[model samples]
Target: MRWINILLGLAVAGILGFYGIRELLADPVYFLELFLGGLVRGSIYALIALGYTMVYGIIQLINFAHGEIYMIGAMTALIVASVLGLWGWHSAVIAILAVVFAVVYSCAYGFTVEKIAYKPLRTAPRLSALISAIGMSLFLQNYVMLAQTPEFQPFESLIPDFAFWEPYAHIITSVELAIIITTVVVMILLGMLIKFTKIGKAMRATAQDKIMSSLVGINVNNVISTTFVVGSATAAIGGVLIACHVGQINFFIGFLAGLKAFIAAVLGGIGSVPGAVLGSLVLGISESFFTGYFWSEYEDVFAFTILVIILIFRPSGILGKHETQKV
Candidate 1:
């Protein structure tokens, strides 16, 4: 009965979506612009969603602090750029260094966060670990507030002002182009790394069964730490690109982005990488179209509404595999 309802709902959605796509494409210029915007945003969401999915897949923990890790990354970039600007550094140099510094600091933060906040709770009750994650999130947010001031910091754009076929609905900006390219490249490289590398094998093994991986002489703890590092690194890159695109940052910026990315992870199937990517793109495109056509203030409402529908119909997500437990 449930499957029937889901199939019916999906069919209706597909029909509506087909028409929507046609309407959007009727104006190729506008459609291209909106699509590029959504792709950029979705790329960022997918990067962050991978972290959520990976952490949950391995340990079944949400690591709510993940968003703050992204915040730290953006904050690091902002600081680095500001400092370089004061030194009269070239825009290119400033941009490159800012991204580098952001990634480094985020990696360090990620490693420390996992060790201090998550590692201790590995043997504790599930609820306890969850509470600890929330507590750490608050602690990181407040810590940044105190350290960096609770004001919005302006991020200088490193992307040169360049556009392609601007008369046709501002086809795409250089920043957006770079973001899309970088995201796709990184995802591909990551996929290849996971598929072929030794560390990747260990990660896969650990994800499958930590106890068994450890029994077979795999360093489970190292794999877990590496997972956090990789996730944080991707988030850091996203922070750099997003901040460059948006031109401002604040202590609280990560909260909403984190929430949306988590939603994307859940929507894509909590443990599937490809699912995360698909979910992020869907959520991003939907939000972009909604904001453009409907009132901007309610764009978020539309996104959440979609989430509700997906949860009601396909809680496992578009590509996520459902698991069955046997007693």
Candidate 2:
């Protein structure tokens, strides 16, 4: 299976490269635009994927409601920003506060979701937990729709409108620059948290062996909550950035983005942070290039196709290592 997956991956790469080269030859200028779009979009996917991957890593359960958390984040940001506008206080500083509010709200929602929906099922069948996650997802989506209106809300970009390297090409926009920079900074901080901090050590220990970590006094529940908090916070940031870039968002946005991020998590190896990021980049870049140069109608189809190809070849996923269980 591994060999087959490797071969298929190579084949896909070759086919994509063939067409990509042709497209580049046809229009180098437009290709650059597609590349930039992919990079920014991929960062958003990576942010959401971190939440899906992290929860799975610690609890061995997929928190399907995570996408709704992303949605809630964006909703929170929009509400806050719009309210502040009513007070005649619209500025970059206010925008930053809106993001902070979103992050805090997301953290609370993440914790509450875990405690109410997942805590009781800690020792139950994994399937039960999975079902609960799906239920929570539906509930949140409707709850938000009723509370915040189902109509699409436009997000204001805090960064002033500007362009760089205009003469050379339509290189990068201000919002895209903000997103890429924010993602890079957040990823670096996440890496450091996982590596240097005491809580990071506890979380790693918990992920490795929950029973042993508990025996050694690691307060496993706290670590799990912390994981959700961090994951939710990042997803919140992703939500705000995505809203700003796209300029509009609806309640249903989370479902699609969540599915893509879930695929990315699986594609890159669900339990590995770096793998999640890598998968997101690959999916994002591939999707952009396909829609840009080929056919926009099949953009969503492209990610699923890659998912099927990857699953058929390697059930463990691109960066996932096979594990054996003993009875």
Candidate 3:
């Protein structure tokens, strides 16, 4: 099975490369545009997928409500920006404040959700926790809908264009460039945090063995809550960036975004951070090409098809380890 998967993966890669090179030669500009567009999309997905991957890595539980948290972040930012804009604040300042508020609110919500919906169920069956996550997702969705209108809200782009980059603006907008750069910086900082910080060390230990970590004097609860907080922060940034790019947002936006990010996480091996980013980029680029060359309406169909293929051939994900369980 492993050999078969390897062969199939190689074949798919070769086919894609052949077609990609041909398309690049045929229309370099169009191809580059699609590639950049996909990169922007993948950056947003990577932000949200980080949260999904982190939580799953530590607890082995899928937090469905995570999407709601992302929505809340965007919604919060929209509200903040609207209020500030009415006061005639500068767009850059408004953006910074809005993002700060979004991160704070989203982190609060993430931490609260863990305590309220997941912590008590930590020792319970995985199904119970999963169902709780779903319920929380629904609750947050309706809560926001009632609090804010169900109608789509306009989100002004906070990213300012650089005068020096005018020549290349047609290929990638300032907003898209900002999103990509921000995702990269965040990923780098996150890598450092996970690799060097005391809390990061604690998180790694807990993910490896919760009981042993606790026995070793690490505060397991704090580590779990911290993970939730950090994940929420990244998702919030993604929400804001995407809203800025799309120019409109509704209560339901996070659902599709979160679902796609989850698929990316699974694709890259859910528990691995690097894997999540790689998976998101691959998914984003492939989707871009599919929509550009084929039917755009079936993009979701294509995403799921990839998911199914990965599940069948590489369930551990591209970067995930194959673990063996002993009876």
Per-prediction TM-score, please? 0.94, 0.95, 0.98
Collision pairs in model 1: none
Query: Rank by lDDT, descending?
Result: 3, 2, 1
- Model 2 regions more than 4 Å off: 1-6, 163-169
Predicted structure with the largest TM-score when compared to the true one? 3
lDDT of 2 by residue, 1-327 (tens): 658757977897799789888889999878988898899989999999999998998999999999999999988998898889888895876798899999999999999999999999999998999999999999999999998788887777756675453454347787888898999999999999999999999989999999999999999999999999999999999999999889889898899999999999889989889989999998998899888868999888898998997787665677888868756
Residue 158 deviation, candidate 3, in Å?
A: 1.2
What are the lDDT figures for the candidates, one per model?
0.87, 0.90, 0.95
Q: Give candidate 3's TM-score.
A: 0.98
Candidate 2 accuracy as TM-score: 0.95
lDDT of 3 by residue, 74-155 (tens): 9999999999999999988998999999999999999999999999999999899999999999999999999889999889
Worst 10 residues of 2 by lDDT: 161-170
Model 1 ranges off by over 4 Å? 162-169
Q: What are the clashing pairs of model 3?
A: none
Query: For residue 280, what is the lDDT in candidate 3?
Result: 95
- Candidate 3 achieves a global lDDT of 0.95
Which is superior by TM-score, 1 or 3? 3
